[model samples]
Target: MQPSHTPHVLVVMGVAGTGKTTIGPLLAARLGVPYAEGDDFHPQANIAKMSAGTPLTDDDRAPWLDAIGRWAHDRAGLGGVVSCSALKRGYRDRLRAAAPGVAFVHLTGDRELIEDRMAHRKGHFMPTALLDSQFATLQPLAADEAGVEVDVSGDPTEITERAVAALAHLAPPQ
Candidate 1:
């Protein structure tokens, strides 16, 4: 695609502690768009389940995903960023259905690295105990998905920079 200044929605996606919360706002700021934290849209039941070290089922996450999708859909025309675990392809598809043309930036890293980060994290509902479940459910962006996968081995600033640079040329699935 030719260079353009059009604004777009970008889903900063990954499991917990991959820096979705840390990097999403930064990416949005760099893009000059509004940002939303996907966690804020989670229903209390979903939070309770995760907080209890329970892996949320697809049934438990439907509304939460819908809410985040709605937020993205509302801001799609002018561009925005939102951070979501979006572990499953179906979940991402739900978000995409609500807001077509939105792109994704998947933060990925080694399991040990992610678990270490999760273990040291505080004040988050997600427990490190459920990380394996998260990983099991995670579906990397498919060939038909519009996205880029950025390794989380770098510093947050560098990761954000990489996301911005990648988005410049990334194309949405047709």
Candidate 2:
């Protein structure tokens, strides 16, 4: 188990296939917090749109982001991890507005690698063709954002270790 630290939520974010769903629960387990799958917050209509290979417009995403924001806000100081494709600055901003202290873990990787991973993954609605749109929409965390950028180059354990290490400073005193 991890040593005691402050209770703070983590939003594991990145484009599809970056392993947010896989690594988020691992991070939460290590930190001894609950895990929320962000995809679950999407309305069926949103899923249908994605399933049709249509990228969601900002208007289409508003309610979904708000829902995730509410979840994050509710978990404040209770310590939780949630997976979100927080791909845009505006999206991240909406989350921050809802939960001011929520920290992000932006997973990054090469596009080709991500495409291959997506192609092989089963039972996911996000089509591989949309990866380009996600990349286009992604605005890397600004220097002032409260988060870390972990490269998605290794196994999940190694990546989690890196994320944990990177977030060490954010942890409160025991």
List candidate 1 stretches off by more than 4 Å.
1-3, 172-174
Prediction 1 global C-alpha lDDT: 0.86
Error of 1 at 91 (Å): 0.9
Tens digits of per-residue lDDT for model 1 on 48-148? 98899899889988998899888888886688899998888899999999988788899999999999998887899899899888888888999888889
The Cα error of candidate 1 at residue 4, in Å, is 2.5
Question: Per-prediction TM-score, please?
Answer: 0.94, 0.95
Give Cα-based local distance difference scores for all models: 0.86, 0.91
Cα deviation at 102, candidate 2, in Å, is 0.6
Worst 10 residues of 1 by lDDT: 1-10
142-167, model 2: which lDDT tens digit per residue?
98788889999999999999989888
